[model samples]
Target: MTFWALIILTALVTAVFLGFSLLRGRDTREPAAAYDLRVYREQLAGVDKDLARGVIGEADAERVRTEISRRILAADAQMQAQTAQAGPPVWVTITGIALVGAFLVGGAAWMYNLMGAAGLPDQPLSLRLEQAEILRAERPNQAEAEAAATPAPLPELDESYASLLNQLRETVAARPDDLQGHILLAQHEANAGNFPAAYKAQQRVIELSGDQVPADAYSHLAEMMILSARGYVSPEAEEALRQALQRDPRHGPALYYLGQMMVQVGRPDIGYRIWTDALRNAPAGAPWADAILAQLDELAFRAGVFNAPEIPAPAISGPSQDDIDAAAALPPEERQEMIRGMVNQLSDRLATEGGAPEDWARLIAALGVLGEGQRAIDIKNEAMEVFAGNAEALEIIDAAAYQAGIAQ
Candidate 1:
C-alpha cells in the first residue's frame, strides 16, 4: 500500500508540473501582429529623436518616417485580418492541455505496468547476494542426490573370475607378509567389483608397507571405500584421502577423489579448482585426466562458471635450434625433466581443454619421441573423437600418428 501510494504521489506531482508549464506557455504567446506594431512604433520614435538632434538631413528623416509608417500600416492590416479569423476557443485550449497531461501520466503508468514487477517488493543488493549464495550451496548437493538416487547396474562377472578371486584371497592369507600378494588381491577385488574386499586388502597392503607406503596406497584405499558406499565420501574415506594428500599433494587419485568430496559437501568451486589443477599436472595417459575431463564441464556449470572457453591447445612448433642449444647448457637429468614437464603440460591441455589438429599432432609426436607409443595412440584416438567431422584435422592427426608409428 505504501509503495503504490508513493508511485501515485510521484505521478500526480509530475502531471501538475507539466500542466502548469503548458498553461503558462499558452498565456505567454502574444499575437505576431501586436509584436510587429510595437517594433514599428519604437522605430518611429528613434527617427524623431535623430531629426531633433539634427544628425540626419530633412530628406533622410522623411524617408525613415515613411518606411516606419508603411510598417505600421502593414501591422494594422495583419491584426485586422487575424481578428476576422476567430481564435481557438478557450474550451479547445483547455481540452488540449488536459489531453497532454493525461498522456504524460497514463503513458508513465502504462510503461511501468508493462516492464516492472508492480506488486513485488524491491530486492536490494545484499538480499540478492545472499540468495545467490544459498543457491550455490544447494546446487551441488542437489546434483549429487539426483545421481545417487539412480542405482548403477550390477556387473556381470564370470565364474572363472570368482574362482580367481578366491585363489588370490587364499594366497594372500597364506603369505600375509607378502606385500605383492596383498597388492594383487586388492587390484583383483577392485576390478571384480568387490570393493569391500578390495578396501580390506588395500588396508593390509598399507599396514605391511608401514611408513614406506606411498600416498597412492592410501588413495586407492579411499577409492575402494567410496566405490563400496556407492560414491558416498564417508568420514573415514575423507580421512584416508587427506592422508594421501598429506603424503603427496599432487597424487592424482587423491586430488580427484578429494574434489569429489568437496563437491558433495557443497563446495563446487573448490572442487573445480582442485580437479582442474590435477588435470593440468596429470600425465598424458593418466586415469585422473580422463576423470577430470569427463566432469569438468558439469562441475563448471554447477559452480555458475559456465562459458569458460575451451582454450585451444598451444600451437605445436617444436623446439627451435636456439632452444635445443639452450637445453644443452643444462645437466642431462635436468634437461630430461624439463622435456618431460613440457610434454606433460601439452598432454594435459589437450586432454582437458581440447585443441586444434596441429596441437594434437604435435603432442602425439612428442609422446612418440619420449618412447610412449601407447599414450600417443590413445591420444590420437581421443583426438579423432574430438575432431569427428573435420576431415582436415583427421588427416593431420592421422599423418602424425603414422609418422610416430602408432597409426594402426
Candidate 2:
C-alpha cells in the first residue's frame, strides 16, 4: 500500500511540474518589437527639453528631430511586421505539451514495468539481510584468498644473523615469560623481514605483557600480520588494529593502516578522512607522514573531496656521508670535536624540525659510535615513544641501536 501511495504521489508531483512548466512556456508578454522607436521617442523628448533650455540652436534641433522621426517610422513598421509573425499557434503548443506529458508519464511507467519489480511486494529488512548473507557467503575475501594462494617470500638472511635468530628462539623457548625478550625478538624478526615469525613473536609479547601491553605492541602485531600476508589486512589483523586504537586513539600507524584497509574495502571517503587527520598529526618527515602526503591528492580525487588538509614540513639538514668521511682524516681530537658538532647539529634539527625514523636511527648510531652509550639509550627510548605504533620504523631503529651497542 505504501509503495502504491508513493507511486501515485510521484505521478501527481510530475504532473504538477509539467503543468507549471507548460504554463510558464505560454507567457503572454510579447517580445520587445518597437524597442528602437521607444528609444527614439525618449531621445526626441530629451532634444525638446534641451532646445527649451537653449542647449542647442533651433536649426540643429530641427535636423535631429527629422532624423529621429524617420528612424521611428522605420521601427514602427518593423514592429508591425514582427507582431504579424510573432507566436506559434496555440493548438501546436497544446499538442506538443500533450506529447511530452504522454512520453514522461507513459515512458516511465513502461520502463518500470519492463525493468523493475513493479508488481512484486516490498522486500523486508529480514529478507534483505538473508539475501546479503547468501551473497557474502558466496563471495570469498579476494585479498585473503589471493594471499593464501601466493605467500610472500622472506628476506634472505646471513649465516651469523640466522644463527643469532636460532639462539634467540631457543632463549624465548627457555624463558617464555620474558616479555622484553619477546618484544626484542619480534623487533629483530621484523627487521630481518621475517614477518610471520615477527607476528608470532609479537603475539608472545602480548601474551607476556597481558592486559598491560602498550598500544604499539598491538599495532606491531597488526603490522607483522599485514607484512606476513604481503599487505593484506586479514580479520585478525583488523582486530589487532582496533585494539591498538582502543589503547591509544591517536596511534599514527593504526590510523594509517586503517585508512589503507578502508580504501581496500571501497570506502575511499573514510580512508581520505582518516589519512588527512593522520597526516595533520604525524611528525613532519616521519615515514607515515611522507606516505600520506604522497598519496593524498589521488585519495582526495577518488573520494570526491576538493579540500585536503595542507600541512607544511620544515626543512631538515644533516651531515652527509662525505662530511663523515672527510672528518676521518683529521687528528683524533679534531675528529671527535667535529663528529660531536655534526651530531649536535642533527640533534638540534630533529628536536625542532621533527625528522624521519632513519634520521632518529642515524642520530642514535652516531651517539653510540661516539662512545655516548647512555645518550644513545636515551634517544632510543625517546624514538620508541615518538614512533609508537610505527612497527616498521621502530624495528629498523632497534636494529641500528643493536649495531651501536645501545644497552640490551
Number of the predicted model whose lDDT against the real structure is largest? 2
lDDT of each: 0.74, 0.75
lDDT of 1 by residue, 1-408 (tens): 666667767877887787677667667767788889999999899988988998998999999899889989989998887744345666776787778767866777787788877788888867865664675454433225435544445577667556655766786788888776777677767767778778999999899887897787899899988887788776678889999999999898899888998787667878888888887677544646676777889999987786433322333333322222333333455435544655787777766776667778877776665667898898898889999999988998999898677978
Residue 14's lDDT within candidate 2 is 80
Which consecutive 10 residues in model 1 have the weakest lDDT in total? 319-328
Q: Give the lDDT of residue 195 in candidate 1.
A: 81
Candidate 2 Cα misplacement greater than 4 A, ranges: 1-149, 312-408
Candidate 2 residue lDDT tens string, 15-95 = 668866766666754546456777899999999999999999999999999999999888888777774535667787678
TM-scores vs. true structure, each candidate: 0.45, 0.50
Off by over 4 Å in 1: 1-153, 174-177, 304-408
The true-structure Cα RMSD of candidate 2 reads 13.1
The candidate that achieves the highest TM-score relative to the unseen native structure: 2
